[model samples]
Target: MPQTEIQILNHLPVELLSARTEDLCDILGGPTVINLGGKRPRPLVASSLLHGNEHAGFYAVQRFLQMNIGELPRSLIWFIGNVEAAKASRRRLEHQPDYNRIWTEGPRPENKMAMKLKQFIKEQRPFAAIDIHNNTGKNPHFVNVNVLEKKFLFLAHLFSEHIVYFTEPKEIFANAISEICPSVTLECGIVGDESGVDHAYQYLNAIMHLPEIYSLTETDDIHFYESVARMMVPPDTEILWEDQAPTNPNYIQLSRQIEEDNFKDVAKGSPIATFGGDGRILVMNQKSKELTDDYLSYSGNQIQLSTDSVPSMLTSDLRVIRQDCLGYLMVRRRLEI
Candidate 1:
């Protein structure tokens, strides 16, 4: 479709994104980007829709742009990632393109969208990039910060005195985007929920006014380093894996020792967590276990660990690992990064 200048509100669904880029330069001819030329450059880019069904964040982004275009930082840019998937409301390109997974290996040399975003980011080199997303569940409050160690501490200082990080360096969904810019993902909760929309709006408001955010700064860099050091969990702690499939519930647990003295016949409904070649965690839940009569009669119930259950190994004698967010607690541990 030919891109044109977007009014944002009425035309949001029609690709204001393509418009932004087209307006900036006729390089590709559609709608280009609108560069905010100012004495001091702004370093923020807010983007969304890496996942297809995650539409609330994208909508919120459009709404935010509408209300605060003038107050927006001079160098800030708004983007819609995975435009194809978002358009179809699916996870990725029909069956071949996985927008979230594309970052795993970096943009394909010839892939148009990936190459375009990569080139744009490289040219701008913003200080921070905030990507919005929807969690798999109904809870709208979860947020994930998957930053390179060098950028972790920078986030801590910029965002809050308390910012959480994944214990290990797993292949993250946003790795490709973050590799070029400081980044954060706001899980705006489950879509279809008005509260989720509200959560996204409030978050956008806070980020827009955040004092710490600007073109990259030394102070921001220091926090990034500290975040890297602070979020690494120690080895030896076992975290039970929860599957993300639609049929499964997400929760982390301590793996039960199969060789322990207390080991008995497998329970009929108990879950078994295993791994594949690259250590990809696989969770077999009670429903499947019961079908196979694995062992005891255990029902799958979703539960978060009590605050007291946070691994003690993280105390005075152990290394300080990342903590959970306000009103949330650390539930399970992940293996070494």
Candidate 2:
């Protein structure tokens, strides 16, 4: 079967702007790239809903455009991705590849749409790029970048002072777009938080008028962390949380408040989770090495932190945990400036 190409529109589907995120599929039919002209020629490419369950970006972008109407300060190429997954409120369908990860150079059908979207932004010579998202866990608003460059750091600081620089997930949209322009991913807290929507809307409005992104100066108050490892769970291991404990040996039992550990300066020997049997939580570095014991202490059926560092994106959602990751382990680092 031939893959679906992204739908390209030169103007906003203003009539469908009010459509709920889940209902976008019926209108857009699939992934879409909308290019709207502004006072400036070079566009600012902003993408949203790469993960269908993340709706803050979608709504924020829509609201920002609606408010601007015909007074945009800069051209924009906003790609609304994963509408199919949005229809069912899933991150991605079982048979579908992650939309965000497909933007890297690849030959998959989804990558075709991503590459097409990339081509659109590349043609615009965008001054900056932003991919908006919402966490499934209790996480403060923050930004993520793939590079340690000043422009990327400053671009991220515009959204939040808490910035994470990661290189391992090199194929994600932000990472790929960084090569073309300064790019950052906005983690706008969790879904259904209006503050997140407000922040994202404010961000969109600010970026529409940005002059030169590369020279923007931010404060020394920024909190920077380098993502060094990913935390994962075995596929067959069942997750038990929120007052539920393992009745079987295949389950990993954790506190419902495990997500509260996100962004905290966790001390060594901090409890993470308890295994049902002899199994352990998996922690892997950027090279995909299994250094679980180096980062975690697992004995007596409990998993504890062996390193003093900050953890981010900790989620209790079992599907997200299995599909993507339990969370990421990060270490504090300073940019040379």
Candidate 3:
């Protein structure tokens, strides 16, 4: 079958127009803020498909423009990031590598596609960039606000209940987008849930009209890291976390060690957390905000504990961190071919 790329904006459906690296730069032209009359003032912008499969929000944005039409908030601008991925219904560029994992060095302005987006953002320095995606499963609706930036807390405070930080900080502040903008990544609840889609659509509506409902505030007193923690997993090992672990607003895990039965005590590489099943093992991975700090020890049995540094988002190797460091954090995949 011939592949079709879909770029739907507002209620009007546009055929996926292939961008010459130059044309894409034009499309990524930053936020076009419109000001409608309101007692308070704020800018709300939304974009989706930083990764392809996590496409629920893109549809939500589409539904939003359809229903609201001329009624959309004056200051709100709806955006679509991975025009290429969304068009193909896949995650990243097929021939090209994942975009989300890259951000260390800026995308070459001369590069066909990246330059287009670079120019767009350069032209429109939005107040915030609300990227949307789906979580791995059907869990409670959640939001990821990269914690390093102070502006992220505003989102946590504004949304309160649904916020989930990707860091060890127990507070609502630790989100990947926190550094980039007062941004939020809406995990609109399991990818396939239509209700999740509907609910997210409502939230999008609420955000566009944010100034109407909540008072706006700003602060610069926030914690950001120069160096990041990296996770280096040895071969043949799997890792998992409790779903509720990130539920707390201020919870941070410093060091975690896994106790598995695969290794022997008398010999090398003792078991840490067992992989799969009951009583298999216990595990622990250290979580520390400051990279220079030492991990606190738990006074129990010795498990196979390793402290993996948090990967830098700015690396050529995208495997280091879980969140998008630059641009919009997206699902890590491709749609082309």
Among these predictions, the greatest TM-score belongs to 2
Candidate lDDT scores, in order, read: 0.42, 0.85, 0.41
Give me candidate 1's TM-score against the actual structure.
0.51
Q: Mind giving the per-residue lDDT tens digits that candidate 2 earns over 1-337?
A: 1225788899898755688999988888888888888898788888888999899998998998888887689988888888889999988888898887787767788877777777778878998999999887888899998887888887888899898888876778998888899999999999889899999999889888877786546558888898889899887777887368666677778888888888899998888888777555899997889988889987787788998979998998888898878999999887667
Worst 10 residues of 3 by lDDT: 326-335
Q: Tell me, what's the RMSD of every candidate?
A: 13.1, 2.2, 13.0
Candidate 2 off by > 4 Å: 1-3, 214-219, 236-238, 241-245, 299-301
lDDT of 3 by residue, 17-128 (tens): 2232123324544212222322233446565555565667667766766676555564454545554554455566556445454332344321333334334433444456
Where does candidate 3 stray beyond 4 Å? 1-43, 107-119, 147-151, 157-162, 166-181, 212-337
